[model samples]
Target: MKKVSKVFYITVVLVILAVAFGAAFPDQFEEITGNIKTFVATNFGWYYMLLMSAMVIFSIIIALSPYGKIRLGKDHERPDFSTATWIAMLFSAGMGIGLVFYGAAEPLFHYAVDAPTSEEGTGAAFKEGLSYAYFHWGLHVWAMYAITALALAFFQFRKEEPGLISATLKPLFGNKMNGPLGVLIDVLAVFATVFGVATSLGFGAVQINGGLNHLFGIEIGFTAQFMIILVVTILFLASAWSGLSKGIKYLSNTNMVLAVILLIVVLIVGPTLLILNMFTETFGLYLQHILEMSFRTAPLEGDNRSWLDGWTIFYWAWWISWAPFVGMFIARVSRGRTIREFITGVLIIPTLFVSVWFAAFGTTAGDVQNSGIDLTQYKTELVLFNMFDNLPLSLILSIIAILLIASFFITSADSATFVLGMQSTNGSLTPPNNVKVAWGVAQSAVALILLYVGGLTAIQNTIIIAALPFSFVMILMVIALFKALSKEVKSGK
Candidate 1:
């Protein structure tokens, strides 16, 4: 009989038990998760802000340092994929569904609340809304991803270590990285990745269900959302089985094309001049306030502190939770690229795309609201479809948007399953089929349970709570990576 790896079975069993317990005791689970989430946000919100700012600054410094010239792989090796395909896969894995989910809703929500430093529904409010959207989806999150991916790539390729998160820290912990500590690190990573991806899957299903409800008048409820998860889980499991080169790459490229088409249609059909102006002004505002916004915590805003916890702090935690899956996937595809190239692509390209995406959908939605469209009655998940209702070919565009969401969901899940398999199977670059299938099922099961428990609030709380520990792990990874890089430079690599 083939000997099964202990990490694989241990992680699987632990996750299964946790999900089963949560499902069986839904109220208790929610209470616990909610309390933990609040505690972390209230106490550690400043830590998250400072850590994210440091990550952003660290990534830039590394990219500009002399070590930037070092290739992720061997000295003479070239990139595995072309630039366009690489960027597509990066964006697809990093924040595809999130961009679609928040592009319209977040800006409108910010506008309604009169988000910090602006009055409600005014021109400044619109710009502030887009600026906050940009801040949430901008370079800082990408910097978190880039730093993790860089560490994984450098250790796995340059130093010939296994592609495990703990392996990147061998410089600090030495042989202990191969023992219980390493197993613990990998297990926490598995937990974070599974929950993070499941939360995303749940969010995507909700929006897809909302789109369907708007298009065909289907009732929006748990039944419909579960069905969406079931279908997407099957689709992505098959994609995971097809492996990365065929399934993930193809879906990512297709998603990029569809997203671009939707973007162009919206820009042409909606208020073009308004979107252009908003993009220009918001881009400028984002640049001007990037540093300020990066460190903003509501120390003096009384009850408004909850706003920071919900939006900005929640986003940072969400991104950190997602870093394991996204970072591993990016590392898997990023062999042979230089550190500078990887950081630049991961940080700049996707941030630019997100800015354009937000400017298009966000500004259009803001315009609709300003023109007396009452969007307050709709759920946040349904906001995009509601925005579409006011545009040309509403039905057709809604369907197209639904398809885009589905495609993004599959791509994200597909990559996540592959990464989970790798993390569980001792960092195999190509994890086995059965392992992939197992992760696929596990992810869907968790999403289904969270959906049944408390819908979006449960999912958000789960992500925030789950990401707290992993954020500290990421800080350790940065230190380990820097230590390793210094040695590499001294050795004249």
Candidate 2:
């Protein structure tokens, strides 16, 4: 006989209802979500900042502590994948699409439009912009992910618990996590995963459309973007049908190769000297200002505070929302490693790669913008393509970028389906194909509605709102992890 978890039914209903409402009354839905999103950012901004800071501190302390030697799985069990493959998988599943989408646009925004703390269009703004971009995508983001993955992997692999977020908290809640409360916790993780991945999918779709517009003369609008999502949805669904190891492993490695190739070409043709200079200087600036930027609130100035809400606060919420999916996916692939190795690899490797990545793409965009040509005239998605126009082999670069985005879109969405299926099916590693397919459709549908109703702003609004409840859940998980780790360390396990 077959059994099903209630989480699958409940979340499907909730997502369907929300999608239907948004589809029926998009303007009203958009307005309501926007209001709620604003409310969370304005009221809870300080809480987010404090929590994120704590996450970073905790990750570092754990990696360097005696508990660092604890294996995620049994002491004798070896890693399921090699270090390179493991990194490629985690990095691809972590920030594959985002790095491409924002690599060029974000620093340019801070430099040309409104700088975070400095005046726009100055050398000061240039440094400030890139440094902040590094801060957003660097340690804090990875710390949140590292903690979540460590906790889940520790409990699931070491303690022989089910591979679910709720299971990680049993040290505190005991068997209370086995009842309705546990179901509630799992449901929150599932919803956050659904919305977070959908938001990234929306970004990927828009950027793919933007690339097409630049290369071939296709118009960039809702219709084209929706079709783009539809096509990619079908593609990723097919990948999901193929199951986890074969589909995700191949796609993730492919994503890394294409990404490295694109990165190299951008550096070669676009201001190599300046890119290296910015990489060296801004990496220092990022470290020097880490504490200041991490806890900054801009309480006095209205404009700076608005920028905080838009960028920093929003990113805290974004990474937290994304933590469940990325964290769980990371845990699944990170079996048999010591806690210290896992955290160190997760934190330092991707952070350094992303820093230099921004150096290449972002410094190039800033260089082009400084030449008295405005790159901001294009939409956010189109900014990368427009910047490429100024470099040699512009057409070749655009083609490679489009290919890379599509590949990332498939990998991210495909990895997400497996994670969502596991969450819904009581943490089954091999969740049924039917369940994964259903989740694939659900995520794509949510993305479509978000794009249809309010475009990019809607994606941001929904993610901010989705992340707030999950933030509480994540804090509790951190406490539970500490409690369990302490008991184990005392017992000399």
Candidate 3:
């Protein structure tokens, strides 16, 4: 077997000890992490909002600047994947299961259950619900991702640096990044990736369990979700075993097809006109109030402040936690493209796709609730299935939804295993399978531990805690990348 770096052994041991602690003292683990998570959210909610907003602005300026012409690779190089395939791969790896997991649930939550500012189940809430959904899942999420990916791709491909997050900062830190500081940076990234992907894995298990319960009367509980995670862990591990290009590529393209089918079916079978109407109106409102929402701390209103802490703040942390994994995976596949094209495509394509996705599923959900279906009666994980219950071909739609979630579940874990393996192995493009297996198991174990501790809330808590330190690393990465880009322009290389 190949010699794995010290980083691999260190991260594996850390993940194991953390898992053991969570397993041995689940309540204590949950309470401690939960308290820390709340403290971070309360004290640093403004920081989350401001940092995310700044990243979005940074993404736009770089795409429009003269540096936009700089290719990710050598100037003569071209993109590795076709445009459509590239988009599918990035979108699938970026936000696949999230769209299914929250498509109907998030907007509907804001609309009927606990709206941001408006009275629940009112016209005002309806608009605000979808608008907030767009706000959360749209431009900023991708911008956070785009900035991280841009830094990695620029440093790794253009400058011929190692494909590590630490390597991206070498412009500012120089060879010091190759010392203890670099190892610490990579470890934090792995820590964030492990907990972050584990959090998504928890959601996937819950939603899959929710779908099974909704479809076949299976009980929705930790046992069932545990089983769901167990089965998925085996499957995605197999996908990881199959290596990256063949199975993962096929899966990514298939995800897009299935997602498109689901979206069109829902729009056509459900309230098509209403879906279009909400999409147009809410999209406008999302753009109109984006600045307000971007910096909104809601210091005055207790109810809205609580809502910000719960949703907006949580999402910012979630994206930051996800940045390392998603950013690395994206940079891996985004070679040979110009910075402008990369940022614009990574930014716009998914933004438009998810905006329409929310419109179709969320508007239909709101319509269902308006028709007196009481979607609020269902759990968040089960809301989508129940919402489909009031629509045409509900059974088939639910089936497709489950399959999509499972596919995304496998693809996400598969990609994370690859990313973890690379990060731990000094940025090996094809890391040893043994290292991948270690990461794959560790990820699943962490997911199971989180579910055992407190289910979705626990998952949220872990990611929030993991994202904070990495957020600081990302701040430095932006500075390093800017320094490198300026040097590039000056050298005329």
Compute each candidate's TM-score over C-alphas: 0.98, 0.99, 0.99
Model 2 weakest 10-residue run by lDDT: 1-10
Which tens-of-lDDT digit does each residue in 127-199 have in candidate 2?
Answer: 8889999999999999999999999899999999988899999998999998999999989999999999999
For all candidates in order, the CA lDDT equals 0.91, 0.93, 0.92
lDDT of 1 by residue, 1-493 (tens): 1223566788789779878988899898888889999999999999999999999999999999988999999998889999999999988999988888888999988887546666777788888999889889989999999999999999998888888999988989999999999988998898999999998999999999999998888899999998999999999999999989999999999999999999999999989999999999999999999988988887994547877999999999899999999999999899999999899999998899899999999999988998898875689889999999999988888988999999999999999998988888788888899989999999999999899888999999999988988987898999999998898899997
Candidate 3: minimum summed lDDT over ten consecutive residues — where?
A: 1-10
RMSD of each: 1.3, 1.0, 1.1
**How many collisions per candidate?**
0, 0, 0
64-159: candidate 3 lDDT, tens digit per residue: 999899999999999999999899888988897889999999999999889999998899899999999999999999999999999999988988
User: In model 1, where is the ten-residue run with the lowest total lDDT?
Assistant: 1-10
Off by over 4 Å in 3: none
